[model samples]
Target: MHRFLIPKELKILVETARRSCLKKPDLFRRGGYHRDLQEIRWLLDNVESWNAESRISSVSAYSILEAIVLFFDCLPDSLFPSQLYSTIMDASKSFKNSLEIYNCLPEINANVFVYLITFLKLVHSHSSENDTDLPLFADTFADVLIKPPAALSLSQIPKSDRDSKRKFLGYFLANDVSHLFQIDLLLTRDEYPLLARHLVRTGTN
Candidate 1:
């Protein structure tokens, strides 16, 4: 199901997430254009070209996923000041699709998925502290926490698998390299297996 990698639905989700990022005008410093954001916008706009194996390497697909996570991670906590809950809730719906397919994705993309989920959990936590009314992402947050991503299960990985083409989302989850990629800093107890697996992989390879 390589088609799952870059389908119309995935493209729409990226576009919607991009639009949500742009809605926060203060994301850019006064008088300075957000050149970095433009890169992500371009990626969203040219989804077809990037997904084309002949045009850009398929490795670039992970770039698209990483860029989406970075967009929200880089934003200030004050994003969508006036309508934070509604706007992020809408955006989270788009991201929830990624979460559903977390196991099917490649390494970097899967890491991005975990990071996004963590980000949403933090957002929901903050919102509920005062509002009492849970944010829209509450359900998604709960669902992900209950199952955790299959990618994060280090003990389940086979010992002899070494095909480079093999997707490593699960491997990444069981590893400690998330910090190297600027993913969320707070590692949960469930992520300890990830660190152990990462160490084993690094030593063996």
Candidate 2:
């Protein structure tokens, strides 16, 4: 598979988006999910600016995508109206569809892609009055990162980089999951036993 270059600026922009969503959950609340649509629209408009100057590695691209997933996962349901769910899901689907233009170098992490797709599909289609499954998506996200379903042997990624990537995932899952748990408890008072389990596992490691 051919590798696609990800610009440093684009990566930083994605991280910024994540931070905006997490650190300031209300940033997109004014317009609801449409605010997210605006963010995606802006990214699409700037897609042309993601040139090959000081391009990022393929692994970094995957990390950036993971951050995007985190960004969406962090979005609060209270801030988004029920009617906008489909719009948000459609926007996310379109964004993922755009990613298909560039082959994920060496190999695509099927686990990550599948988990994100499933999370989005469930959220987009759910009709229950109570949104009990909100934390489930966050838990599943942390699970996917901490223990990726399968690690494919890829020639493009060196052993050292692979090990580093694993370490990074572990670190991210450990800190991010705990932080998310606190946020959820404070914001929604939701119980997330999965988050607790992962935190213990992370602590043990």
Top model by lDDT, which number?
1
What is the per-residue lDDT of model 2 for residues 30-126, given as tens digits with 9 covering 90 to 100?
Answer: 2223333334434433444343212212223223334344433333221122233223323323334323311221122222233233333333233
In model 1, the worst 10-residue window by lDDT is: 196-205
TM-score of each: 0.23, 0.23
Error of 2 at 164 (Å): 22
**lDDT (tens digit, per residue) of candidate 1 on 47-129:** 55334222222223334333433333332221122222222222333334323344343443344445544433333344423
The C-alpha stretches of model 1 lying farther than 4 A from their native spots are 1-100, 129-135, 138-205
- C-alpha lDDT score of every prediction, in listed order: 0.31, 0.29
Candidate 2 structure lDDT: 0.29
Best by TM-score: 2
- Candidate 1 lDDT for residue 100: 39
